[model samples]
Target: MTKNRWDNGITHHDGEAREFISTYFSQTGRRVLILASAGFDLRSTAVSRAIAQTGVTCRGIFIREERPNADQALRARADKNAEQLKIVVPDSKVVFIDIFDPVDQAVVGARRLTRDVLPILAEGEPPTDIVVDASALSIGISFPLVRLLDNLYGQKPGTPNVHLFVTEDPHQDDQVKPDHAERPMWVPGCDGDAGSDLKSKSIRLWIPQLVLYRTEALRRIHDFVDATETCPILPFPARDLRRGDVLLEHYRTLLIDTWEVDPRSYIFAAEREPLDLYRTLLRIDDARQKVYGQQGGSLMVLSPIGSKLLGLGALLAALDRDFPVAYLETVSYAAQLGAMKNLEPDDWPIVHLWLSGVPYA
Candidate 1:
């Protein structure tokens, strides 16, 4: 088997992440290109502010989700963040790409990004490093963007390295809810040929990251996948000791009655450590491959419906294994009225992962 790319990946959290941003540009001759969300979420411009403090010469592509029935307060907040992002990265060429089609409600983010941004990355004097702030950008957008950049520039020598950044706070995530969810669909660029019937002979093992308030999304995806086996990923050693237990109880009915997931198949990964989840998934897939390699074979399908940290881990594993990432695209996210009322800005810790770059070379 080929070695896992992120077996010893570079990652930083909290103060270390801030310090890395402060010194990264000064130490290396790299021009950075940051793609982040310009949403109502407080952490939308978090990474931008960190990079600005480093005096890095970089550009940004701020994603703005277009919602028709969005709350006025939330819309105002999004607008404010966009302005703040512009102020923080004053010298950089910044662009705003609107996601979610207004008419049919079909996710056109991947298509729009390919049309508007891919050319820029391929042009002369492209950025030497690409950073994606996945804190606020929905998985529908961030996953495809990261996959595209990696396929385009990360795998080759003298090409830009791809990095993922996020501000993680499970409490904050629990407060926000996705409303008006649409039917489940395969994430663009991470489909792994799931639609083809040629793989019907292969045994399908579905891995889903469990999260609060995402029961419906999980159910939709589970029914869509109809996998032969189900392995649920839960966060352990979490900030809240009872977090994993609470999630298990919340999804007890679905796990027991609906999906019929085995208790032995539950995966416990650290909430703060993305690499832990990465290594865990790699081991499980390796064992399965060993047993089914010469047979009809086996397929691992992942559904990342949890925290951004866990989602990053699932994204990494899917990229390495070429598995399908199934997800439920939301029609519109519910406005946060008072859910984040008591939370302070510092509650969310900044997280960073350097997926590929000079360090690996």
Candidate 2:
């Protein structure tokens, strides 16, 4: 809202993303640090493969969740991805961070990152580029890391370039279902003041990213936040023209009946373009700022329960304004591995965005 630098950001898609990584990372004297998740999702290794194909060795940190109740097939797939990452980047030492508190399922991943990953970034030979594959990691895990990097390098010119990579497969995403979601709570560092301590005069705006089969989770968050205004974001100019319609119809009961969201309150942005969503959110916040600047200040709480690309957009916007992000972390998933086996690489579009660095400077 306040003169966002990434309003007109750089983004790449599909083969173009691969080409960018290959050409740019293959250059001489480039110290690249990649942080990705070791997950059962098919797109877990897409970015790593792209970087490895360029013959450019880089540091790797793969996040592993310690979920005892996880499906066997899913665990196998995550283990397989972790091994494949090692094989792909054979020259470098890949550190794995196990980020899960088995007892209470609290948000300890950020604490683990500070202990395990922060020292590496703060070393004398700091990385020149930090690439985060947001596809496999949950929003709770990825948002804090992104915020940390932004706070560390976003303001400093010629600092480490921060890049975001996400492999988007709408169909594949639809196939996987989240199960046993925890209560809605604020994400670690992005926790905005949605609690009881918030001032009574403050206007709260809730922006939720729409997706399929997340009604229950979203309902819980909506009740918790009790926002003054609701602006639900829908995917427009999507790969499928009917997606926006489908989502609106799917959520009609919740939006209209439950939340009483206005017809004119719908926000739409390109499906694969994070900057589109980023700019749209900033515009909304700009209006709030102008109207409520002299008041107690408006609070925008974001719920990104959709695509990883959209989640990245939400993270970028939150970093700029310190917007609160509320989410229900999944305790276990309910996915059928066989259902996703037939998916081809071409079906998923790999996206790469240059978030910050010398290029922008």
Candidate 3:
């Protein structure tokens, strides 16, 4: 396994992901903190643990959102997961936090940075490094976790380095049920007339993060903007046969029919490699700023990203500069009793990781 770290702002690495995990566990004086969304992806979790040569201290911080239906399912799975973790790695501390306080959500800024999040990590000895998996999470919990991790990195410089990872294996061959959407709305990134003539300037840039569930929202954008001015960005995960062909066809029709632009040309696409997605956002923002700085009257917009790490990257980019972000918020969610079809074990190996909050002295 090879490793590559980011140069510009916050340091991030991308390499053979499994290799990183193996190397991380093998080191001495390391403590592991696994944030359990539901349960550990048994396969990946075992592989990571097996590589640890030195005896490593490990613990789990399980998440239970304030929702009733979801929490019920999560509780059952988390209990089983905790049992399994204890068996695999003895005496591991397992904690369950009841998050998603409505009042907390209503709060304007970061509510739990010092209060809830820091306290959780501060428990036990400080970790040397942290490995976070954002795969099992839906949009809501993942958003807050991403925000929390970002805040952690922003805070003390000497804090332990974080390795954020997610598994995305959209099994193309499997018959999948469509995700239920309460309403599919595609709101603009910045405040201008919704259908304002996009051709006012020769250069307008739009980067819409693509996913199967957001088909309607993407269509809404295609209808709203000149397709030539848009750069549709899709996440190419390690294993993603993300079968959004219907949505892709719909987008292709609009781009060709309306703006006469090649889908290939109006696309700034790449595979998201761990934290590099964060770097990609920074780079995209830099390019957009360069465009506007050199030539006034050019508009640039960043659309909503589905992946937690990538979403955090976009958030960081906007925080520094007034980067516009288009959003489609979900009103409700459905929780399945069993593993969801396409998102099951065959699509993915159940994954969890040991994250260290403090580097060993």
* Predicted structure with the largest TM-score when compared to the true one: 1
lDDT, candidate 1, 204-266, per-residue tens: 999999998888888888889989999999898899999999999999999999888888999
Clashing pairs in 2: none
User: Any runs in candidate 3 off by more than 4 Å, and if so which?
Assistant: 1-15, 39-54, 66-68, 71-79, 82-115, 154-156, 172-205, 217-229, 235-247, 250-265, 272-284, 294-301, 304-326, 329-361
Q: For candidate 2, give the lDDT of residue 227.
A: 89
Top-lDDT structure, candidate number: 1
Worst 10 residues of 1 by lDDT: 339-348
Q: Write one digit per residue (lDDT tens) for candidate 2, span 249-358.
A: 99989999888999999999889888889888988889988899798778889999897788888888888777889888777777867777555444456899888888
Better of 1 and 3 by TM-score: 1
Q: Residue 136 CA error for candidate 3 (Å)?
A: 1.3
Q: Higher-TM-score candidate among 2 and 3? A: 2
189-211 per-residue lDDT for model 3 (tens digits): 22233234642553556667655
lDDT for each candidate structure: 0.82, 0.81, 0.47
**Cα RMSD (Å) between model 1 and the true structure?**
2.0
